[model samples]
Target: MQSDSDRTGLAIGLSLVALLLFDAMGLIIKHLSEHYSPAELSAYRNFFGLVPSAIALWSSRAWHAKGRQLWMRQWKVGCLRGMITTLAQFCFYMSLGLLPFATAATIGYADALFMTALAVPLLGEKVGKARWLAVGIGFAGVVMIMGPGSQSFTPAALLPLVAAFCYALSGVLARRMDADVPSPLINLYGTATSVVGASLLTLALGGFSGIRGPGDLGWIVAMGMFGGSAVLLLVISFRMTQQANLAPFHYFGILFAFVLGWIFYDEAPVDDLMPGAVLVAAGGLLIVWRERQLRRARLWGARGPHTRI
Candidate 1:
């Protein structure tokens, strides 16, 4: 029992760490992109992040022995996830390059709404009316932020939205994957695959990008470390607390991105970011709350209806 408590506390800490780490990712990507192409940055992030973990796993003789599928056995599913993640990361990195980190981060927040909306058709999960309303309200707020009608749309603005959609799909598949394999194994393979693919794509486009020195190499490595730790910590977090309780914490990334933008890039957010942030954050919170409420209702809803006593 005490172990469970300890684990819970550790999980919460890891989760917060994961959120902050993720918050750093876009800013870091943006910074690196200044010196390296998106493909170069993406490759470095994916490759370095996996290589050390892979070595650690190898020395431990883990060699993915516990993965539900044999090496390459889960290729189809794994590859599907890999592709989505690859595109998502690329788009996100590109967006950071093109837009303010805070602005792009705000747009990315809509991924929860995408994921919630995605559950209905793809997974056959029943989305209650409240959840539907939440998604709609949240998306409406997104339009406000983007200002579709009044402002001319820039192609760059779509980057985060594209990233969100790909990520949402990948997220759903990840749940299916969790039932089959350890999260670490799945992530390890995916990272390795994504890095390799990204590198090849980069080289194919143009060879040997701005990797001209030692300092750049160090930041690339650091980016990898942050990313890897985040993936692992997030898995730990989800296991600790209920998704509802943990869900609101996602918004912290926006805050992290905002501060980083203000300090380093000197980029500040406008009034547009707040309303959407509030609506999306509020909608997500309410959806979670409504889920819990409905859960309680269900437990009692059929109590007297079907009982003969």
Candidate 2:
């Protein structure tokens, strides 16, 4: 058996590896965008992703519990989450193709800000003034990236913001339904939803006409494998240690995305977007800090007043 300290270290290591793998998927998606539509690539991602999800489900014995269905108790809610996740990923993949990786990543990370606001209605969670302030700062960071009313505004630049909103909504659903739904089932349904949705949209757009060769197939499969593996690693990491300890490491993906962007695509954020990225990063850190404080307070309160006898 691993000690708590050993598990924590392992979690941290896994978290870092997961983030890198996620960035690798993003890089692969960006490269494949030259050969396929975002919708088509999304289909590929979800299709191949199902393979690992099935493996994880089988390995964990999550497909069927004692006398329970695979859909768990709340099948409707799970399906709704799946639909929301599909749209979120489609928007994100589109933005990945349309914008610089660093810029797209900065905006996508703003989903944390969206989630804070959405939590008020969805989760019935109270947002303190500090968190609201963090949310404001985060949105400001987004505007800095967008440069509203400026020549820097490309319609496609808004795709990531849409993606962020959809992601936040999906996260809200996931939190609400997490009690009854196992992670594997959640992943399975979500990937299935994406595959079907993307396929429908692609067919409506005139089918997969861009698939030129096996190279395209290879890129798509690689993207899917990296994406699925990242989710598995992230799930394991969170289960291993305190989530607060792992929360900060999420920003590490942005840094890696920037480095990867520069190296492969020779891409760099513009002057304004770079500053925006800094602000977004800061705001995200503030939110994480505030959450940690809240969690600690709850734990302390649960312990009752410490009698300094």
TM-score of each: 0.86, 0.93
lDDT of 2 by residue, 163-214 (tens): 9999888878888775645677777777787788888888887788766788
Q: Write the per-residue lDDT of candidate 1 for residues 2-104, one digit (tens) a residue.
A: 5866776777777878877776766678887876777778888888778645543443323355543436456677777877888888888988898888888
In candidate 1, how many clashes are counted? Answer: 0
lDDT of each: 0.76, 0.83
How many residue pairs clash in all the candidates, one count each?
A: 0, 0
After aligning candidate 1 to the native by TM-score, how far in Å is the CA of 231 from where it should be?
0.9
Off by over 4 Å in 1: 1-9, 51-73, 151-153, 294-309
Model 1, position 258: C-alpha lDDT score: 80
Q: Runs in model 2 with CA error above 4 Å?
A: 61-69, 178-180, 306-309
